[model samples]
Target: MNSPDSQWSFTAPLSAVPEAVNACLDQYFADSSKEFGSIGSEFGQAISYLKDFILLGGKRVRPMFAWAGIRAGLEGGGGSLSVPFPDATPNPKALLSAISALEFIQACALVHDDIIDKSDTRRGNPTTHRKFEEEHRQKGWLGSPEHYGISQAILTGDLALAWADDMLLDSGLGHKALHKLRAPWRAMRTEVIAGQILDVTLENTGSESVDDSLKVIEYKTASYTVARPLHIGAAMVGADPQVVDMLRRIGHDIGLVFQLRDDQLGVFGDPVVTGKPSGDDLRTGKRTALINLALHKGTESQVKKLRDALGVVHEEPEINDLRELIIATGAEETVEDYIRIHSQRAIDTLTAAGLSDAITSELVALTTKLNDRKF
Candidate 1:
């Protein structure tokens, strides 16, 4: 097992990972576009929209973390760098293609999430369904615009998911590497789906506590966003079992930290910055940990203010009121403390895992950037 390396710190450049991932995604999208165009121009037009949606904006968090996982696996695999340092790692382009699948997974999750949330905008633009709805209206289509939008968006998300599988299988990593990746990939898909179901169930039934909220993210965000991606990377190279186990724990902690930050962003982040309307969570009646905390601790009137607005208020002023109530109850600060505690736990665990300075530094750096989401 690796031991803590004090020299490690996050110094990796951000540009390289996203750029590589984007280039690979472009190829995959082009390949897909060609296939769709061969079928029909209507199909071609829709795919073009999907392509723009994907390439528009994103942090590419999952693929970067997956890369970190790959590094971790490489260090422990056997070669001076890993078990299959030179061989199992495969060509650099192939590795990027494989991990880039995570971005598609993210796209599918978001497209579906927006549908479920009935969100009007994403990344400050109309959501998939809304975009399709506008196109339907523009072209004077024959059916209900709303239904057409929903159906098309669903298909778009499905295409993204199908292509995610294709990208991984076609990545040229060879049978052994692909076989290793399958387990985590399967698990991540299930966990995210289960998490989404749990989130919807809890919201409709009323999630009232921090534990309930945590349970939601544990499956919904943690595994899909962090833990399993790490597993996929480690598994990609057949990383040592002990190293894999350590990363799972670290990923879980980090995933929670990431989701907690998301909770804040959901309620407080600027639409310009977050790319979605502030208080979308509130409008959707989604009870995140921060909201749950406020519900438990806020004054009667403040609590009432939140309750009255839950799932009803769509415009301003009221949303602002709800935001203030959360702050006034001190839940925002309390959640920040929770974030500090969880983030520290993740870092400490990673430090104690004692992986190579290279892997340790990159993971720490990624975690830091994830945690420090001021916007």
Candidate 2:
């Protein structure tokens, strides 16, 4: 085991990748704006909203994962960064394009996610629908301002997603690499839509068992967040079966940890850190870890309270009370412990795969940073 500063340390050095990716995002949106028309201000505004989402600071974990997979495949046998490419040729430009594609795809997903969840903000900024809604009201838009905002934002997100696919296809990856990437990329998109439907269904109908909700979380949050990205990236570089299998297992462990951390943050992170109101999850009555815990472990009376809180999304003292109750019931601690364990497990899995220290170090660092995220 390598004694290191922390899991997040390696990530600090990787920040430049995200900045470059953001520059690409800016260009992408600018092109979209110009395509719509010089004077299509509404379209321009929507494109700007997409740019804001792309520029919003995040861990950039998915893009980094994609790059790492490409690197691993290019190096062959999945080892340290010290390992040179087979031909001793580094394709930095191609790698950067692929990474940007991953980030843009994530942006598209998040935009759609906010609309589905009716979230008001993201990364400390107004969500697309929320921004459009406010703009509509301020400008005294024609009939049904709220509906118009939602409709336009949804369409904008769809366009972003379509563009993401185009970026990936046009990323200049070789034919073999592109073919490898095709299946998982296509599957991920299809599954995400299916997952979204399941999510909406659960929110409306409610789950009788925690396991059911967990299934939804796995699909809606996990596969896209970790599994598919890993597979796609690995495929891009023509990873062999052994390496692909290892990446899948690692991706599952890391992805679940990522979602678990998000659940915890939804309940406990600072408003400034999370870019949402305190107890926002509770207000939205999101079926998160906290609610799942209450449903599973609370007394009957507490269960009733949790049910009542579902989908409220309003300002109320009871929302805060529910947050406290969730913590008091030990759900928060349970989730925290779960995150710590799986995060370490991910690192251990990577280490045992006999990867070089440099690669293992970076992978461990990525897992740690995500697990420890404040936002």
lDDT of each: 0.80, 0.71
Q: Give the TM-score of candidate 1.
A: 0.91
Global fold similarity of model 2 (TM-score)? 0.87
- Tell me the spans in candidate 2 whose CA falls farther than 4 Å from its real position: 1-15, 30-42, 75-90, 309-317
Candidate 1 lDDT tens digits, 93-120: 6667788888888888899988998888
Residue-by-residue lDDT tens digits, candidate 2, 44-150: 77777777777766667777777666544545554322222234343455545666777666777787788877777787888888888888899897888778778
lDDT of 2 at 286: 74
Off by over 4 Å in 1: 1-15, 76-89
Q: Which residue window of length 10 is worst by lDDT in model 1? A: 1-10
- TM-score per prediction, in order, is 0.91, 0.87
Superposed Cα deviation of residue 99, candidate 2 (Å):
2.1
